[model samples]
Target: MREDLTFTSGGVECAAWWYPAAGATTPAPCVVMAHGFSLTREDGLASYAEALQAAGAHVLVFDHRYLGDSGGAPRQRFRAGEQREDWRNAVAHVRSRDDVDAARIALWGFSFSGGHVATLLADGIDVAAALLLCPFSDGVPRVLASPPKTVAWLLPRALADMAGRHVTVPVTGQPGERAAMNLPGEADGFAATVRPDSRWRNEISPGLFATVAAFRPVARASRIGVPTWVGRCADDVSADGKAIGKLADRAPRAELHDYPGDHFAPFHGELPTRIAADQVAFLRRTILA
Candidate 1:
């Protein structure tokens, strides 16, 4: 069953969906999840959460503050540090639930949030397992992937936003546009994940560029010290596959899997089911064991 819930993070109330484990007679393993980049919970996350719930794991899918149904000001802001704190609070909320097994909790993240999972684990969140899909492991590659012209166009706006101008930019756009992600197919890939009823916006604070430039989760991979499953999109342009491979190698007990298509592939069409099944199998051997 799915129930709407809210949790506090950084003094803001964040919205979430709670999927109780089916037929659980005792405390059950729970997977804590959130969306990537400027996306919200409704953007293709329910499928995986439902799959995990069906496999007897409680699932909690939440929206980061300032996005989706969450309450926060200066909407569409995306801050890596604050988002990580939201993940921490979400895990803490799950652990407080009487029906959840605190010791068997797992962290699930996609794209940008995927990097958050690694950082959280390295920072010692005490989770038992982690599932990352097309994670943005290194910002250097991401910045390098952008066209020089795009970078030149975005930098000043990003700096202006950082200086309190609050400049907003499209999260994705045509190849020649001045947006965060404009690589061929990236805009369409992101659009495919948006549900018809989604409240997600296509704009975000330009300051996100500054955040991505300094965020490198791959550097902390070795400190994760937990069973981690890293799913890489073989053709991803948004998140560097080579950096993802490095993350898998550095993570003490990580298993790396390659999927077809680009960054958003695992969340679209038949891939979501297949990918969720693979993740559930991993959980079966770890969190749900």
Candidate 2:
């Protein structure tokens, strides 16, 4: 079953769905889940949360500061730095709960924010495990590898975003929607799995475009002491597989699972449920070992 959780961070009200374990009467290991860029808590995360919860773990799936049901000013804006704080705050909030095991906190991030988990680990979050799903490991390399034409159009807005203190860009659309990841195909793949009744898309801050240039989570993978599981798609064109491989190499304790599909397969069709099951199995071994 699922439940709603509301917590305050930096004076902003944030929301998450807590999936309680079956027959769980006391505190259980918790999985804190977040979505990728242009996505929200409703985008393929609840399935995973429920899977984990069914496996005797509590899953905390939340919307970021400016996305979904969460409270934030100037909605749809993306702040990489602030997102890191949100992750930290989410974990803290979960820790304070009586039904969660504070010492067995794990993080699960997908697509763009898969890279966010690495950043959080680098910042010294005491997490027990990390499950990354098609994460963009190296932001700069991934960004630079994009079509130069696309980058050119985004650079100006990126620059404007850097100086404006708050930047906004259409969440998804044609080629020029935003400079960050989620090009046309990626955007469409993400949109395909939404819950239909949710209003989870809009203009993300141009600040996200600017921030993408400076974010590099792979560089700090060596410092991520927690157990890590990276699930990648062999046919994923949105994220650099080589970059994911490189980050996996740097992680002290890491495992890589290559699936036979594109980026969105792990979140839709017959694969999502399988992927969620696999994720739950991975977390169980890591947290209970």
Best by lDDT: 1
88-132 in candidate 2: lDDT tens per residue? 899998889898878999999998789999888877898899999
On the 0 to 100 scale, the lDDT of residue 10 in model 2 is 67
Best by TM-score: 1
TM-scores for candidates 1 onward, in order: 0.98, 0.93
Question: Model 1 — TM-score against the truth?
Answer: 0.98
Note the residue pairs that clash in candidate 2: 167-205, 167-206, 168-206
Give a tens-digit lDDT track for model 1, residues 80-175: 789999999999999999999999999999998999998988898899999999898999988888899999999889888888987788999989
Give the per-residue Cα lDDT of candidate 1 at 236. 93
In order, candidate lDDTs are 0.91, 0.79
Candidate 2 positional error at 132, Å: 0.8
Clash counts per candidate, in order, are 0, 3
Q: Looking at model 1, which ten-residue stretch has the lowest summed lDDT? A: 206-215
**Residue 52 of model 1, lDDT score:** 97
Lowest summed lDDT across 10 adjacent residues in model 2 is found at: 173-182
